[model samples]
Target: MSNSQQSLGDYGIDIESNPESQDRQDPHTIGILGSADDYAPHSIDREGLPNINGFDWEVQPVQYGPAEILEYWRLDGDFHDGLSHEKIPGSGGIIIRGADDYLREHALTEIEVPDYYTRFENEETHCRWSADGRTHISWRFLKRAVRLSNGYGRIDPVTTRVILCDTGHLFVSGPRGAFLVDIPPGRIFRNGDDLPEPPDSVYETIRGIQVPEENPELRTAFERYFRLLSESPYPSPISHAGFNGADHVLETTSEKTVVNDNNLKVLGGQTKPFEDTVGVYSRQCESTNFVVSVDPMHLPGEIGEEVTLSDDITSFGSSGDTTGIITGYRTNWREEDHIAPSSSGVSTLHFNLIVGLIMPDLTVTRRRINVATFEP
Candidate 1:
């Protein structure tokens, strides 16, 4: 009998010497078997099966060759594609680029990735995947290194510029341009009181000041001045001089004038010469003399009430202060002869007040004045 026909009495099985029979029985075999002339010495049964245990196997029919088998196992489902340096989300870790490029982009120096392998002494395996395959990387090392390199926990100093606008608006200028923000009006105190309204011209001038990023000092100073103006109720006068590196000077002038009715005649004399002239000219005489017609009803006292013109006349000035007095007064009547027979030929009464003044002897001198009633 051929070797294929051999019988195993212990195992109650027949041995097959044919290669095809051996191949067919390979799936059923689990342990080492006796060597045969057709089988290679290094060859083993179940060569294609998985080495792991407790795996569920499913057999599906296939018409081509041997039945196809599929093996299934449990997986965590957390695996994902590796991330590129630029594709990493969020800010913190240094980007994967040259030092110069990184510095230029972030305005800071390059920071190295953490080396957890060298830092930790534990037996735990820490690794990451690279383009080629799995690689070793310590997240803890990288996080610490990045934190240190980036100054992650420290507070960075920031420079800001504050500007006060004349429109009662407060502007804050920083890395960004001046931002008009609504600031509480009373919150800004100057000289222990609320700030006053700034002139519109001041706003226009400040807006004209060029604040380029290159000149930080000048920009900062401008901002500081703005803040000072906003906070103080009475800030030091701000002018073009301050911006031009000169001392700030304050100039104030009267806004209104007060005039006494008694001074009307005096004002008429001083202003009479200029009534016809177009251009400005100085008076040649020390005192001006002029005649004024007065209404009977406007006279300070009753008719026939003998009163001094100087006592009845009060000086009027633009600043609400009396500046001069009425010097003289008289009354005259002239009769009109009408040729018309229907006319009654009534006489017209004229009351004239003559005003005279001596220079450098005035009791009250005013910077400005207005006359309410005067006719010359």
Candidate 2:
């Protein structure tokens, strides 16, 4: 437990190549770069599993420090262009970091998107289809660390270079993407740590999704992360009802759907601490909130049923001055929605519901709740 820290390469992978030296003595062992005394050796319960690598990966908590931007590359037309650390206007990476104030202070702020890229629609500009549309876009990946705090003061940070692009939204990939929100400089917390409440810079939700009214499990889970009222006017996407089955309860159409469906289930409302982009965190309200796209055609339900509502739904409504519901739906045709022609036909008609969700000290969260495809 008191072993001295070992030297590891830039990304924490040991790059030692001397095969005959003690450095490679444990051929199957992977080393982490930090004082071994800082963490307990994370053991894997491999009782029924075969030894694939002959060793399991260990958890080593790296020292907490200020965020740093080591390099940047120009992801030009389709990104085949080559890599350069030289700063180019209009283009910047996302910043994923710990929710801690110290790390947030040290993280990089926003960089504008180049006029050429920004002028073009986000859908057209963000993809990797260069001239011929058949070439593989090159990427100069770098490992960046995401900081995590136990809320009580213990801090741990981990590194990642992976991003998952689903349908159209971008996610941090791996465990990091699990509990993300559009809050600038996304905040991640260790399990059981009291998560910070919203309206702060860290607790926004995916725009269009709302809490399920009948799902005690989901509403209970959502309330863990957001503040909701019993008498609120807005409606929740019904999931499951007890005996008299509810219709059009928000359900995933398929088991294979990735981002939206899976995002619905954050374990115990716990999120792994990390941020998404590569620089100091900045809340690009347009970009971050703009990315999440819910499918309009195959809206989730038990089968082929549209949502049931006796009243006409607007973008928002008022039950009273202090309380009402807010749905995650937004105009499918925002100015930036110029990528594909099919997108023009997607549903965008739902009430904002947030205007009425006013609470005295608690910030109202527009929880991501999937609604039926609107046909006008």
Per-candidate RMSD vs. true structure? 43.5, 22.5
Q: Pick the candidate with the highest lDDT.
A: 1
Candidate 1: Cα lDDT at 289: 31
List per-prediction Cα lDDT, in the order shown.
0.24, 0.22
Instruction: Give Cα distance to truth, residue 166, candidate 2, Å.
Output: 21
Under the 3 Å rule for N, CA and C atoms, how many clashes does model 1 have? 15
State the lDDT of candidate 2 residue by residue for 293-370, as single tens digits. Answer: 333332212111122322233232323233223222222222222347657633333211111122222233222222
Q: In angstroms, how far off is 215's CA in candidate 1?
A: 35
Model 2 segments more than 4 A misplaced: 1-71, 75-376
Give TM-scores for every candidate, taking all chains together and pairing residue i with residue i: 0.13, 0.19
Each candidate's number of clashing pairs is 15, 28
